[model samples]
Target: MKWTIYQLLVMIGVTFFMWGMENINNENLIAQPPGEWTAVNSPLLTFLATGLLITGFYFIFLFEVKKKKNRFQHPVWIYMPQLCMAIGGVSFVLFLIGGTIGPLGGWVEQMRSLLYLILAYFLFLIFLFIFSFEHKRNRSAQATEKTIHLTFFWTLMLFFGLFFLF
Candidate 1:
């Protein structure tokens, strides 16, 4: 993929923005004892960090994925694991959110504790549905003829659906 000056500048700006958000999140470490400002627990900083990271990903997607023909760009087994890390990062954030909010109340609040699991199941379902649809549509962007088997994929989806619904 070709990089441009604009993209580079945007990237640099995002990096700085993320760093500043981190400092905001960890302002306690920046502040010292004796008449100094300490960290304030601001929800805004966390939200801004979330927004910036997502914006960065979308920026990358527009330049890298959407612009390319056959956006898969690599074989599933080779590429998916790396993409999983990004997915995992989001999951971790959701986990943190759920964990933090889970203790605020009782049984209804208990749902917060399982938020990640619930989300993961839906995410898996949607991902599989898209994959299956793409396969049926012959949208396999891979160079080779082989792709992930639909049977195994659907089986996983079925399990998640059963667990989620029943």
Candidate 2:
């Protein structure tokens, strides 16, 4: 049997999806008493599931990019969108599906919070877009540095978001 990175990534994605589904459904493969803390009901599990799914699809897109023999001079820039998408998408999903049930336990409260989170995420997207566009236009060291800075900024945002969410 032949294996490729794509296949491996897909399998890992599928595994993550299955586990996430089980977690969401509150079904544990392990035997435990009913009133216990399981990862099933956690918001972080939902976030992880959403992020992993995005990552899988991104890898498939990368496979297509490679298939066309289009090489990136700055691979980090290419990955920035994936990171942005994963975080933004997860935030949206968490708000939509698990919002009221999460830390903020009311629809109105969650919606208000969502508004701010969305606005911040949108701002980050805009900055990323501008940096990427400028980098492509000028291919300058400064532009590249700004894009890398944005990536790090996004990662830091991810950690803070998780901390607050959890």
Candidate 3:
């Protein structure tokens, strides 16, 4: 049998999805046990599951980039990190509130969620830079190629970025 990078990546993604799904109902996977001093077991599990799912999504993004043969140069990829940032934010919030006693336990889960949130922010920032660079290149090409119109979203983002510098 022959396999390509895409196939391998897809398989890895499937594996992550499966594990995440399995963990969704597995209470034992949490570091803390039920009726324990730490009330963060659920939150920790939620964060772990979210991470696994996002990792799978990332592999899907890689698979798309590789299959398209753009060398991952397309500006559209900026959305992946943006989505990840959103996901990570949600996970952090869940980790924060998943416990019955929010003010009491789950310090470690909070820290882990904070780490994931920070990583997501970094990834989003990096993709923003990449998108800016690619946008300039594409804009230059559009200038020389005589494109009549840009999508409404593109036009909106351009004006917004000009105003906000984001």
Top model by TM-score, which number?
A: 1
The positional error of residue 101 in candidate 3, measured at the CA in angstroms, is 30
- Give the per-residue lDDT digits (tens) of candidate 3, residues 1-166: 1225665766666565555544543545545554668544465454554444444444544444345354345555446445546666685686557545574256535454444444445444433343344444565565311211232234334434544452
Return whichever of 2 and 3 wins on TM-score: 2
lDDT of each: 0.47, 0.52, 0.46
Q: What TM-score, to 2 decimals, does candidate 3 have?
A: 0.30
Cα lDDT, model 2, residue 85: 70
- TM per candidate: 0.37, 0.34, 0.30
What lDDT is reached at residue 24 by model 2?
43
* lDDT of candidate 2 over 89-140, digit per residue (tens): 7767876675456664464453543443344355455445544554455565
lDDT of 3: 0.46
Scanning candidate 2 in windows of ten residues, the lowest lDDT window is 63-72
Error of 2 at 13 (Å): 4.1
lDDT of 3 at 49: 46
Model 1 residue 134 lDDT? 43
Better of 2 and 3 by lDDT: 2
Model 2 misplaced stretches (Cα beyond 4 Å) = 1-40, 69-166
